[model samples]
Target chain A: MPFGNLTYLVGLIVALLIYSAVGTVFRTLYLLLLSLGFLGYISPESLVILLLVSSLSYACYSGMRGQTNRSLWFFLGVAINLTGLFFFREFSIRESWSISSYSVEYALIAVGISFYSLQNLGVLIKEKLQPSAMTIPFTDFMLFSAFFPKIISGPLLRHENFLPQLSPDRNIDWVPGIQRILFGIVKKTVIADRLAYLVNHNFETVDPTGWNNLIVAHLFALQLYFDFSGYTDIALGSARLFGFKLTENFNFPLRATSITEFWRRWHISLTSWLRDFVYTPVAFGLRGSVLGILLAILITFALSGIWHGLALTFIIYACTHAAYLMGEFLLRDFRMKIKVVVGKSVFNLLGWFLTVNLVSISFLFFRSTSCIDALDRIGHVFSCSNFFPSNWKSGFIYKIAVGGDQQNIFNLSITLALTFTVLLAEKYVYRRLESNKIRVGLMVLFMVSIGLFGVFTDLDKFIYGQF
Target chain B: MDNLTQIEAVIRKVFKDDSLIIDAQTSADDIDGWDSLTHLQIITEIEKHFSVKFTLSELLDVNTVGDIDRIIQQKFA
Candidate 1:
């Protein structure tokens, strides 16, 4: 069940209580079983794949401990993980290439393989670096790979960061964990789902126009941010209940003033993974030249795009970001000169505007049916007639936009209001509200708001869960 | 100059901040503009000054100034 479901919430509470009573000796095994149960509930087939992949990684890691040919083990482990990832991710294209049909039935069952494969591969690299120092016990490693909270979507836990925090002796901090869960529920149900209602409606029904597409694209960006980040918050809070800490996935990315800064903030763990594994190796191979860095950016982002899913729109989405970062790099000196001319504040404001628009426009490719559709929509955005606000009112603006049915108008208003309010609150209210009493009060308010405003009619699955 | 001192000098020149002070523990986090791009420039400058080249693995292994110093010392040996 998804985190937003009532059944899942009840199950979580019961799990927390049971977990608190369990002693340290059996805690790891207990949680591992629970994680398996969660996976079994989601997809029994995926649980088997997870167990197989985890076993292979563990076997490879064990083989490396005393071996002179550790690189052999490392490469073997990496190859296995990548092959699993590739088969699962690119299964549909196999027919075109005439690959064997023997495993075709199992293709769609690898739910969390993409994320766990990265974790397993990272462990190999760490083990290769410090042969004796990084050995994890089998049980701990299994739990780390299949931990229920982050298994569906991830903050992409690293072995170095997560292994230390996995001990069974730690105590759960109940209040903050529950608070985080409630806050995440508020973000997902109350804000993101509501916004998705408006965004999905417009994208599906409304004819593609420059004005409408632009607005929907921006809304989709918000919808995506809230959906994914909300899922992360729940994952983090769930991990916290189990006395484990997950890496943070976002850090107020919308406030980023540059594309590089944006990557550092948005989906921080994934970008860092790409940086460490893909970009660093490639750039280093090219002797750390300017050209090398550019090429590394290209290769890393292209892989990143493919990681999200192998599609033309996703590729374009990835390339758009790659281009943004490269532009920032090449224009750094020019931007600095401009920053000196205009004061820092004005320069930052302009940067924020440009970054938000550029990111939102790229989401068009991300959300589109195909790259060509996105291009057509973008083309419409620049057309002379489409650019005129007066022309939009003829039918596009009034009927489908501001003057739509009462429900549509209400959703549009609430979406905009919640988006801006949350943004402003993050900037002003939440940062300064440090009092315990006030925090508790706000938590209650969030719960109440979720009950009243949360869209439960057609529950939406967490968007990142698919990836 | 000592290797640390030489490394410090190269950092100061590449970052264009003469007043910046560094120690063995100094890292990218300690400097204002010592980002990934500037890091490449610093490494390039150090390679030029010391007449040495670092492989991809070696560069990946260097996280702090002390790490770089140790690598250089090992290379010299």
Candidate 2:
């Protein structure tokens, strides 16, 4: 496949124009959506399936007018959405002759469905219970569901949060929006993309044998964090430009000393969603039982794991997290005791290092293709079996990067460093946004980032574009 | 009469907020520590101390310390 899916690109531009200047917002919105969906490689049946399920729910929501059983209907909506996803993925993958060889193929069009399904589901349910909240015109509701900024990936828009923002008649602060766009571009293009080289190199090879490989693994962890969170920053910043305040996805997760705390900070929105909608119910209903907590941990992580794809690697990834959380939960009292007793900087740093290493090991599941592959990779890494040892010399590093991956190690390092610095800088930017001076600083930073690196062409698509 | 002192003590004990004061009009909204997440933790501790289980609806509907105290009074009285 070529780099550009030109059909979707053309379709996206047309849809945007229509969205920006349409008569009846609902009808225009519908037509625009129809066009975007058509741009993708979906079959007639799947397209119909998508439209039918969505329309049915919206129609029910409109008709009920605060009269229907909200929870039951909402669950039904999720069921329908997940079922469609299952059928498309399960059936297509099983059948050797599936069309387009995209059993669970993703492109531009599928960007918002994962997040939008939840948004629309929440809206429909909220309609029956809190009708006054459903003030969005049908058109705006559709836009909110398929908002381009978050459609590909999400800060998982809550319906209650998104709908009202759509109706905002406030003046557009062009300056802030442009600044956010600049920050997003730097995170996505320059830094994250650069770090991606090292991350991908380390993950693609089975070697974890040498100290170099170990360092690579650590770098891989950093790279993954940068890439995903960088995407999220862009997603959020873009969402902000339109006056739609998406939830913060990352909260300086590298600072977290424990897996439990890391998840709470990283992908905070989705993890929180899984907690509120999945984990909490399971844990609470279990009533402090160890078995309950374990089961809840497993189930939540499993779903979280497979949310990436229907693959064994993801399954392992989930299990690793499940184990980490369970271990942390089990050792909570013991840890608090330990913390109180030691209460030292060295102990805290060691704890953080140990926790990060454990997390990196878990990423083996995410990076590898299968459980066996993941286990083998971990075995090699631990056993010091250097499958791809680095020379460590500047000359050799340059050669391996240039002659090897068609990318230079220096370029990768500089990019990753710049990206990391920007994110760290954003920590200051976030706080300083309250001040005029820092806001001006952010603009200068933004301009420098823009002049340095353009927006990622992949901006229209999220990393988790497939599932 | 197990007046405000007992209720206040329970609030202080449950939240580790010895400064918590309970009065007739005092509500969860007015207290800095009275988040809904921690609300049940307090209720559960109170139930352990006083020996009663609240109905689900009652648990969901609670807004004030006085409301909880009144409910406890009703059951015990």
Candidate 3:
């Protein structure tokens, strides 16, 4: 179920109450059952797949315990998970194999299988690498793999990081949890949802005019960040309520000054995962040869693209980033020399502007329905025939005015003002606001603003949940 | 030269810094032009110079010059 749903809120409250009231012995079992129930509620088919993957992982871990052909067990575990992912995600392959319609439908509904399977795969690899590091019971392993908060769209928890927190002695910190949840709710319901309207409308246009496409491209980029990061905040907040600390996925990625820095900040868990599991291994296997390292980076990013979906657009998006990174690598010394010559502040601002625009342009591929559509939208950005901002000003103003509704204008103004205020505060005031009173006051202001002016319509699905 | 001295010479040559000094804790962050690209070049040069082929896991596991020193020692001891 979506985190925004009332049923999920009620369920979380009830579960937390029961969790706190219960003794230490039954806590794991109680949370495990609740997690399984949540999974089953989302899709019975997914629960079945989750159970199968978890069993396969545990069996692999057991087989590797003695270090006899641990590599074989690791490969076997990975093979099974990949086979499941293939069947679930690559439906066209199923069609070629003439798989039954009912089976295809079942595979399609298994939403969280990709994320949870990867979590289990990481566990298997970690076990193979350092057998003595993890010796958790099977039940705790299951809970780690199937935790409800992170199962849907993950910050991709590591077994080592998350396993120790499974203890009943872990203390629940409600203050940060409440603050994060409130921030997540406002970010999603207020900022992302409002921006989604503009993104959808402009992207759906058959022939977007110049400047319109550019505006929409940037809007979609912002919309995606707020949508995905908003989901992450909610997931992290929800997990924190139960004393589990999931990793942060975003770190002001939009403000990054370079593509390398951008990747370091954006979707941090996934990139780090690719770095450790994919790129490092491949690059190392080739003995760190120059060509090998470059190829490893390309291959890792391509796989990351495939992980997003089977779409050509996603592949293009990933390939573009890989190319950007490669370019950055080749020109690092030159850029550093220029930075020294130009002075740091001016160089940083220039780099930030270029990086943001480059990232924004590449996201067109990510947001578009197909490669052709993305190309067309990108091509439209330079067409001078429709570059009349004056002509489009009234319509643009009207759209933001939400069809000239006075209430919507008020709502939009509040959202814009609050968004700028939050950004400025984060930039200027956050570190200085050391006192609890100031922090609490800010939280209260956020809560009151969200209650008063947050957009409640459409309540669209999160962008990253598809992957 | 010892293993560390040989490794330091290889790193200095690959990164084109003649006056570079490296110790156990030295990493990419410590040297100019020591990015992923140059790192591969240094690794390739090390393998050729020492005639020791490191496994993928070994390559990945090494985070510092100290780790490399130990691996080289173990391989050549």
Best by lDDT: 1
- On DockQ, the stronger of 2 and 3 is 3
**Chain A TM-score vs. truth, each candidate:** 0.92, 0.78, 0.90
DockQ, cand. 2: 0.15
The CAPRI category of model 3 is acceptable
lDDT (Cα, tens digit) per residue for candidate 2, span A107-182: 3223345566656665654454345543555566555555555655677877656665654353333445445555
TM-score of each prediction: 0.91, 0.75, 0.87
DockQ for candidate 3, please give it.
0.39
Which tens-of-lDDT digit does each residue in A332-413 have in candidate 1? 7788789879989999999999998889999888877667778877777767675545565545545444456767667666
Tell me the TM-score for chain B of model 3.
0.92
lDDT of 3 by residue, A68-118 (tens): 888888888888788777777765332321001112222364667668777
True contacts kept of each: 0.16, 0.00, 0.42
In order, what is each prediction's RMSD in angstroms?
Answer: 4.3, 6.2, 4.5
Better DockQ candidate (1, 3): 3
The candidates, ranked best first by lDDT, are 1, 3, 2
lDDT of 3 at A313: 83
- lDDT tens per residue, model 3, B1-77: 78889989988777666789999999877875564555666777888889988776666667788888898988877
The C-alpha local distance difference test score for the whole of candidate 3 amounts to 0.75
Model 1: per-residue Cα lDDT over B1-77, one tens digit each = 79999899999887656788989999987885466656667777888999999876677677899988998998899
lDDT of 1: 0.78
lDDT score of model 2?
0.60
Task: Give all candidates' CA lDDT scores.
Answer: 0.78, 0.60, 0.75
